[model samples]
Target: MAKIKTIIDGIEVEVERDSWAIDVARELGIDIPTLCYHPALGPYGACRLCVVEVTKSKWTWLATACDLPIREELSIKTNTPEVIRSRKMAMELIMARAPRAESLFPLAEKLGVTKPRFKCRDDIGNCILCGLCVRMCDQIIGVSAINFANRGHKRIVTTPLHKKADKCIGCNVCVEVCPTGHVKTLDDGSFRHMQTWDADLEMLHCLICDKPYIPAKQFKVISDKLEGIELKRICPVCRRKETVDNLRYAVVEKVS
Candidate 1:
């Protein structure tokens, strides 16, 4: 509730108490790379790419910018030599686990991580294990459909028993939130298939156009939430067209 003054890269700024250091940095046009941070989800500090140097009196230490709370007179440096080194090391370790992941290439270049020192792993695919998908399903969607399965190096995101996830509504929230393109979905008119989770879902077709737009289960979840909205079985495109046509008719009637 209260505002506090903090210094980021020698630029003093006033922000709300308990505000994340990363948010303030970005407000000042400072680029702090992050993989696990989502506006709708809580900070997990999984990727460690957003590490920054925090100076409090005589003590100086590296802290995750995503979860670092801003306090009065807090001093932070995002691109110091130590911070860059830590980020480079973290990126190398992440790249080794997902060497073929194209999404990591830009960040790797920025950090000067030419090649990972560790052995490249082909088993994990592009998953950095940031837990964004899992948390989105559990915290926001409340589905709890997919989760981290194995332990240690064998850990992976999968459905229960590695079979069809009955609870999956085909909302594709996981796919949208995933920093890497690991959780893939394919819509083949008739079915929406989540290849990663091995789940097959029936598509919900638009009533007027007869084209599949979303999964049936996902529609039901949305319709249930809006109990008295009188939801029409129309796709977004058709809905927008209909709204415009109605507005035109109303304007004509008023002019006449």
Candidate 2:
């Protein structure tokens, strides 16, 4: 396997070649903060919170750790004063755009953002414009229902023509990954609702326990892939318990 010798915080560490700074940092037990970079998705450097200082051959500059590729003899400083200042600025900027993002408060405090200095644009709403939802819909699920629309401060993520997209499979992956609560999956125990895209999918109850487990659309997607193999309509817990009970009964019958 290809490898690269990198120096991080004055310690020599070896990591896989072509790996990003986040991957190398993680391998060295370092936790680099990230917002738009999900393990299941490609690196999108929309959030500049992971900025880090890198020096190679007397040249030094800051780069986003999530997208910065690992190179041979690369030296990185994740907690330098300059890096801290840049990260704090990025946090404040994101906070300004997403003041109602309760999920960001912890990170904001960690990055030394007491209060955002930028003016709040209520017209922009609470989204940080990270594009995680759009990327997930396009890359993972193969459904490009939503995308970044407009330009600059006018930019927003929404379905085409700002209407409910019919191609959406009702997967809540977008809502699940959104660090800011901008995307919503509202459920009142009967239906799984994607509020932004206006997808109201009926939730399916478990056959064994009759508790709502999955959305009908999501289930249909999975079942369609499986073809003739009919999946059991039981939640994970009930499935395990039923399997154990059936096994016990079979063992008793064999012994008899």
Candidate 3:
């Protein structure tokens, strides 16, 4: 791997080639505010909060630090006036989408965005369109139950036909990956519910104790991956107790 020499916020640093500007900035202790960029997932650059001014050769322009690759000799400014203005605008846009979202409010206060310039449309939750949930579902979980629909401003994340997909296993990967805490997962009775995708899954109970442990869909997916491995559908506590009893019985028989 080649090391690219770069200047970030007036400090000259050597960053690995093909690495994102945000990653390199972190290495030099530079804090670049980002809502969409997650280390577990690829750069989506939807938030536009990590914009930085770059000057290479005759060109000096703004680029998203999350997606921007450090190539060749470059001079990057992380907290320039231009960058701050762009970040403020991005924060305001996110605030307009999710007004009451507490996560958005903190970022708004930091960027000096008191009120959203854009008109309020609907009472959508704190989904900042970071795409972590969508990416985690499709790439990590291998379940494409939800995705972006429509175009431009009208576009929103939804399930197939805006109804819950049968493939949704109630894994809550979306809920965990969501940055703004928009998605909510509730375990009620024999079902696991996800509010964002409008998905409800039947819970699977332990065969021995009849205690609900996991969702039926999640169990099936895990069972499929485990080749030839037997699953008794028993809770961990019951399994341990059963194992101990069987071991004790064997010891008594051997001693006799």
Residue pairs clashing in model 2 are none
* Model 2 TM-score, 2 decimals: 0.91
Q: Report the lDDT tens digits of candidate 3 across residue range 1-256.
A: 8898999989988888888899999888998988888887787899999999999999999999999988789999988899999999988988888877876777789888999999965656666777888888898888878888887777777788887777798888888777778889898989888866777899998988888878899888878878879777988899999999999999999999
Residue 59 miss distance in model 3 (angstroms): 1.7
lDDT of 2 by residue, 1-256 (tens): 6788888888888888878888878778887888999988877788998889999999999999888888667999999999999999999999888887888899899999978999966766679999999999998887788999999988999899888766777788898888887888787687877888887778899988999988887788788879989988998899999999999999999999
Error of 1 at 205 (Å): 0.9
Worst 10 residues of 1 by lDDT: 66-75
Candidate 1 C-alpha lDDT tens digits along 1-256: 8889889999989899989898899989999999889878877899999999999888899999999888667899998999999999999999998898898899899999989999999987899899999999999988899999989899898889988898899999999988889899999988999888888999988988889998999888888889878778999999999999999999999999
What's the lDDT for candidate 3? 0.85
Query: Which regions of candidate 2 are displaced past 4 Å?
Result: 246-256
Best to worst by lDDT, what's the order?
A: 1, 2, 3
Q: What is the Cα-based lDDT of residue 239 in candidate 1? A: 94
Q: What's the true lDDT of residue 70 in model 2?
A: 80
- TM-scores for all candidates: the values are 0.96, 0.91, 0.85
Show where candidate 3 strays beyond 4 Å.
206-211, 228-256
Better of 1 and 2 by lDDT: 1
